[model samples]
Target: MACNKSFSSNYFLLTPEEVGFFDLIHILFSTTKFEEGIKFLDMSKFVSKPLSELGSGIEVALNLIPSNRNVFVFMLNFLRGRAVKPDKTSATFLSFIGLIDKRVELDGSIKHGDANYHAALSAMASKASYENSACIETIVKNHWKMKFLGFYDFWNDYQGKATTQAFLLRDKTCDQDTIVVAFRGTEPFDADAWCTDFDFSWYELYGAGKIHGGFMKALGLHKNDGWPKEEVKQDGKPPRPRAYYAIRDMLNKLLRQNDESRYIVTGHSFGGALAILFPAILAMHDEAWLLERLQGVYTFGQPRVGDEKFGEFMEKQLKEHRVPYFRIVYGNDMVPRLPFDDNALMYKHFGTCLYYNRHYEVKVVEEEPYRNYFSSLGAIPKMINAFWELIRSFTISYAKGPGYKEGWLLRIFRIIGLVIPGAPAHSTQDYVNATRLGSSDVFVPPKDI
Candidate 1:
């Protein structure tokens, strides 16, 4: 109930339709109907449709049945009977919407919070699919994969985590000093939802912490496939202490396995919030080991998870280990700017914020030389990031190349802009100005007077 005070019902994982459909489909296709469903998919006239179009169609179909979400998933299972490569279809779809980059652009019509990168998998749209053909193929494939896999119901292994047998992946090669962890965020149904497909075993969060041994009722902290929420906070702050211990024990076990590696923490969206907090929490619990071994943090689109007091405390905590930390934001993804009130100004302005927005911003610094320098300075790093994104986009840019939508450089820049911690093109300047996370510079705390 208290947690409800922080994240309203709107914030909970499921909408009424989603909840109904998920449970409903779980029942519908638990048997042969699943196979019949697949047979039905073959009914589509365009079996040979471009993979991207196939995926896009699925997406539109699923979205159309907003209330009957299960039908979309059932259709996927049904289609799989025809031996469609559901995972690849899903991966392609994921790549389309720019998930690989750690963010997904929510269409303006959907209106509200940006879709968490964890939700649907999509690839960049194919060139033909955009102008000449419907995006149905690309969207459908991803939706089918998600539905068949029961991704919408990610906490399928709560019993295992609670029973102390949760699914987790780890590596002993890491320095005992440099333990690394990546929070799986809200969803760990599978990898490849994002373009990175970050190493599962080494990353800790994805393969290691994911306790998805079976079906679950959804009440656990997501880092591992455990109980969603076991302890409630008496104080209105993010559950940092609880999460810290959960992480600390894991690192200790990892270090106990091999004594050489240090620690690094990272994640995307809410997971990113945990990544930043893990070290802070560890430092509080075991300062000696944590501080000495702490390497850095890199989170994308992390939400502000605390009250002003807790936020300030975390600010100092992270600063101590700030050198290696880098928070990447992408393209005005709104999920990153959540759960923060105006009580804390610095953080309100800078901390727990997204680097990008629909309309990019230009800010001026006091006694600072550059006019809108953050935006100006930010442009270069984004361009650099875009270069790599071009490679990824090449797989799916369905738009005509050489135009704004089609140009390799421009399209990929938008893709890169989605995942980097700071918004592409401007927010890196904000990072530059940030004393705690950016390059070290002597900072006099702003006078509260």
Candidate 2:
């Protein structure tokens, strides 16, 4: 299947200013002091202008900083006494920060806007699933109606010792017992995450080539071994991703212990890719009981995982089991269209895509349009088209500023493949906004079923 061409609903939309405000908040929480943090915010131009006008200033600043430096430090050094210059806007912003700080101290979560506005905005918090201590802390304290149960960190030995992280969360206020598996996405500023993000080499898996080798290794599958001999034809099947064995073992124990609990898997970006593959692996191995207990799989800005055959396999299994796989796409999120949509590359996306248009309208479609192969030209057209779309989207959203649109600036940046650290549409908070609004009417299967 190819990309969806339409949206399903128009529920809520986050304004450019509001996007800037949240971006500012993320920046503030990630800094050491109000002054220091505000300095970066000022540099990003995210402090005074809408993010659409200035682009993601936070991402640009993050690109310049060292990767080892912790990006999300929650401590706020409130500037008091005569040294402080109090202005109305700064005062109001500080007051807002103070409120968030209070909420963090009190309940570990801060509400984004008014509760009655929309569920999406209401459910957003500063929480993210990064490797940073502060990010983990915020997630532990926040994350709607869920309590942190445990964290699983896996190392990809095959892929230059890369690390992947996931969280196991349980419902804090459970009407029916539920366990949530959340995965962390690529960190725009972090070198490790960048490495993972760019490691797009394909490996053969389940009779298909072009599966991301790095991701396969990260999932705990090895080169020598293949999927369980009983499951697939052993001729040349690649091993399961390396890290998944430990994860599967853990989930096995959990499922055995709580037979009645429903499991929901979720992630953003790269993590979203993992979330999609996790269940597919389980189902492929004929783990029927585990598949039955799976309530739903939700992903935000997930890239295409495998070829058309892989997608077909996944869709069939998921549909037969009645599992609702929601692939949430935000406005012009380049990641979803990535690893290049070339037919030769053999990459295809699975599940129902719920795309949020430029207006943040929700469009639901079964699959994206398939790009047909054209002789030796292969997927070049598709690749170029996807890349151009990304460039166009990025340009419209971020390159409209004074110096950004200049001829030399555009040409140089294009030649160097310079990218703004984070895509605004792909931000975790943006996903939260979309999901909260879209999931209001979603049905949650019973635990006993």
Q: How many backbone clashes does candidate 2 have?
A: 18
lDDT by residue for model 1 (1-449), tens = 11121212111121112223244334322322221112111111233235436666554443332222456665675567532332323333332223223122222222112232111111111111111111233232332221110111122121122211111222222222233354444332212121111110111121112111111121134333223323344358554333344555556666665556555555555455555555544544436566556555656555444334444555566565443444544443334433222221112212432243222222222211111212445566545655544443454334322111223323544565645523333222212112112222212122320
Candidate that would win on TM-score? 2
Q: Which run of 10 residues does model 1 get worst, by summed lDDT? A: 195-204
Score every model by TM-score: 0.38, 0.58
Error in Å for residue 421 of model 1: 17
Residue-level lDDT for 271 in candidate 2: 84
The CA lDDT of each predicted structure is 0.33, 0.50
- The segments of candidate 1 whose C-alpha lies over 4 angstroms from its true place after superposition are 1-82, 85-179, 186-246, 284-287, 319-324, 340-449
lDDT for 329 in candidate 1 is: 47
Q: Taking the tens digit of each residue's C-alpha lDDT, what string does model 2 give over 63-102? A: 2212222323211212222222223222122221121122
What lDDT is obtained when candidate 1 is compared to the true structure? Answer: 0.33
Clashes of each: 74, 18
